[model samples]
Target chain A: MKDKELLKLVKQAKNYDSKAFGLLYEQFVSKVYNYIYYRTGSFIEAEDLTAQTFLKAFDAIGKFDGQKASFPTWLIRIANNLTIDYFRLKGRRPEVPIEYACENCDDCNLEETVLINAMSDRVKGLISGLTDEQQQVMILKFNLHFTNNEIAKAMGKTEGSIKSLQHRALSKIRKILEEEDG
Target chain B: MDNKLENALENCITLIRNREEGIDDCLARYPNLRKSLEPLLRAALAVDEVLPEISPSMEFKKSFGAKLDAMVEDKRKKFVLPRKASRKRIPPCVSAAATKCFNNGVCNCLYLCCLRCGNDGCIRQQSSRQLTLPGKESS
Candidate 1:
């Protein structure tokens, strides 16, 4: 369905329309799951966060402002905020500086070497070197395919600032990889 | 070969690092370089790469839906939202301009309804046009 239709469904959902709510849920669950998964990096955490994101969206659907952003973007902002809240409550910070950092290697034919747990150690080691902010931007941009403007909106920063931050963050990854190569 | 390869590698790295072109643009340009450079890019990407697949669990949804239904039914607990409603509802034709009214009102039924009605008609019309054109991009 188009944004307008989805928005209509969301409105119906707010009015306690079960069918409309179901349609909206179908429309947004994947986005919510992916956003949560991207942030938390754990299927379990993503699943939990996805649930929380929707529950919150459902609770606050009545107050959603379409003028501020599209329904998907608004939902994403909600998911992102909730994930941040989860981190705050835990008092645990991520070891990686960048967020996404993916290269579509899931199809690498070397299953034993690339796919399963074989590269986990190396991957984990590389990410351990990044800073928290870098990690956030990297994941949001690379993993989730969020534009600089969207990321900036999510992070409460200007687009130019986000572009610069993204550049610096990716540069750090390049440096780390270069060092590893040597 | 290493120096010549190094120059190409630098360009490849910058492109990959910048994410400028298609993901495999450099690899396509230099097959030999691909053999040498892909591992590095792969390693760089893999580091901290978390592939959390989205589980479309119908069971989870049903259980959660049931729980929410119970809460709403049993508690009759009304939760007050953070923002106040500004404009209640606006008619369909006036919607694009009445974005202000939609934002002001807490209930979005009228606004969404109007948008949906308009979009549904527009999309239907576009589809009919595409069918006649046959070779168009099917906008």
Candidate 2:
């Protein structure tokens, strides 16, 4: 659904409309699930995390101010925060190592070796080398098709900061890829 | 980066944005830099294609929907259910009488028993003595 339609649902949901909330859930669960899947590369973990994300979002949606962030961005922030908390609780960072590449086998049905072979190691290696924050921005922006403004909103950073981070990340990845090819 | 590289990067960016716009259309639209940024542009174009599609399972959706319904119902029930102050409870004597008084709400029923405070004691005495009904002697 479009953002305006979603906002309408949100308004109805705020008044305690379960069907409207269900529609909102259907609209966002996949996007949120995919974002988590990209970060974790574990379907089971992604499913569990996505469930928690929506539950937390529903609980807190009453206090959400739409002026500050779009609903998707807000949902993403909640998901990102929960993923971070999960990692912190596990005493590890939430990252899928480049070596353990997965290409949504159910969607595309590509094997691990095929996925790893499809991308130049240079891109994957550089991405893996990036700081967690930078990597998240790149993944959310370039890989996941989130706008810089949306990334900024989701990450709680300024738009200018997101742009600079994206530039630096791209330059670094480009340099690494160039070096590897040279 | 030099102007050439910058222009190349800009072209790459535009191409990446329009990557989903189809290759022939992109090639026809911007013929100049497509040749230079071909590899990077191709990679960028294929990035999303390579990204796996993740779908929630039917079972998970059913369960999640059920869970969401339950949670929302639980929240709604909070408002709809009677408040503590509004809930009514019959006095134990009235409840007992209701049960013993021929199952009718009429207080004037012949079987009506109003033995309030000592009802339990009287019932216990009758039961112990095996008295079947009122005015009966344990023989």
Candidate 3:
């Protein structure tokens, strides 16, 4: 959505307009869900956190400042904070089996599915190794498809710092993979 | 981390992500930075990266939306809401905006409202919008 249109929707939402808030929820639900899904690695927990994020957003919509961050950024920030709190409260992320990540596709070949899921598990393990900010950089960029500027703004940093974080994250993953091969 | 190289890497990664450029295409854009950029770009691209696709199900969205509507309803209830009346009722006069008719005589509506008339039930019908009651000084 264009910034102008988004601004208008946010204004309405601040005024407690249900339809406008619903539109914002629909537009951002997937992105927020995916962010939590990656951090928590459990669909059920991701759903719970995603719901909490929106509920908190609805309650605090009046406090949102368009000058500070874009709506998506503010919304994502809420999801990010909730994810952090969830992990902090739980003490550790439980090791959910990779197979449980997706529903069974009866039509797909079993061998191919197992191979693909294994690869996904390995990739997620590598990403989970990065620092919270670095891992967040990766998720915001790759999964949510946020630009460097948007990520920086959401994160309260400069675009330059965001670029550096992304580079460091990818470089760290590369080194880890290389060490495994060596 | 060279600032120029970082900017180039950011642009190239964005391009690569959007399918507007490939490793070779991004490298070609910054030939001088190739040696440094190529390694990072390779790392960015090399991973067979498929993060989980476990999005919220449809049932979750429907339930959450309904919950949000309930919240909005509750907020709306907190305001000075006007409700439908069988007979047109006057706004209550308990507020400091009470008329200065302190003659110990004819009140505009309070005499009948607080004492007698059934149609004008200001003291009884109960409009919560009565923000302020008359102070002891007024009585």
Instruction: Give the alpha-carbon lDDT of every model.
Output: 0.60, 0.68, 0.74
* Candidate 1 ranges beyond 4 A from true positions: A96-123, B1-53, B56-62, B65-139
Top-down lDDT ranking: 3, 2, 1
DockQ scores for all predicted structures: 0.05, 0.14, 0.24
Q: Rank by TM-score, descending?
A: 3, 2, 1
Residue-level lDDT tens digits of model 3 in B49-93: 555333466678789988887787667555323343422365657
Error in Å for residue A158 of model 2: 0.8
Candidate 2 B-chain TM-score: 0.39
| Ranking, DockQ, top scorer first | 3, 2, 1
Model 2 residue A171 distance off true place after TM-score fit, in angstroms:
1.9
Which digits, one per residue and each the tens of the lDDT, describe model 1 over residues B22-96?
448776887867765565445435432543233334565666667655543332224322122324345566876
lDDT of 2 by residue, A7-126 (tens): 889997876678888888888888888777667656677789999998998888799888989888999999999888878898987555433434554543355447544553443555
lDDT of 3 at B30: 95
Tell me, by lDDT, which candidate is best. Answer: 3
Model 3: share of real contacts kept: 0.44
Clashes of 2: 0
TM-score of each: 0.56, 0.65, 0.74
Q: Is the docking of candidate 1 incorrect, acceptable, medium or high quality?
A: incorrect
Better of 2 and 3 by lDDT: 3
A4-71, model 1: which lDDT tens digit per residue?
88778877767666666666777677767756654565656766887787778777888987776677
**Candidate 2 vs 3: which has more TM-score:** 3
Candidate 2 error regions (>4 Å): A98-126, A179-182, B1-50, B80-139
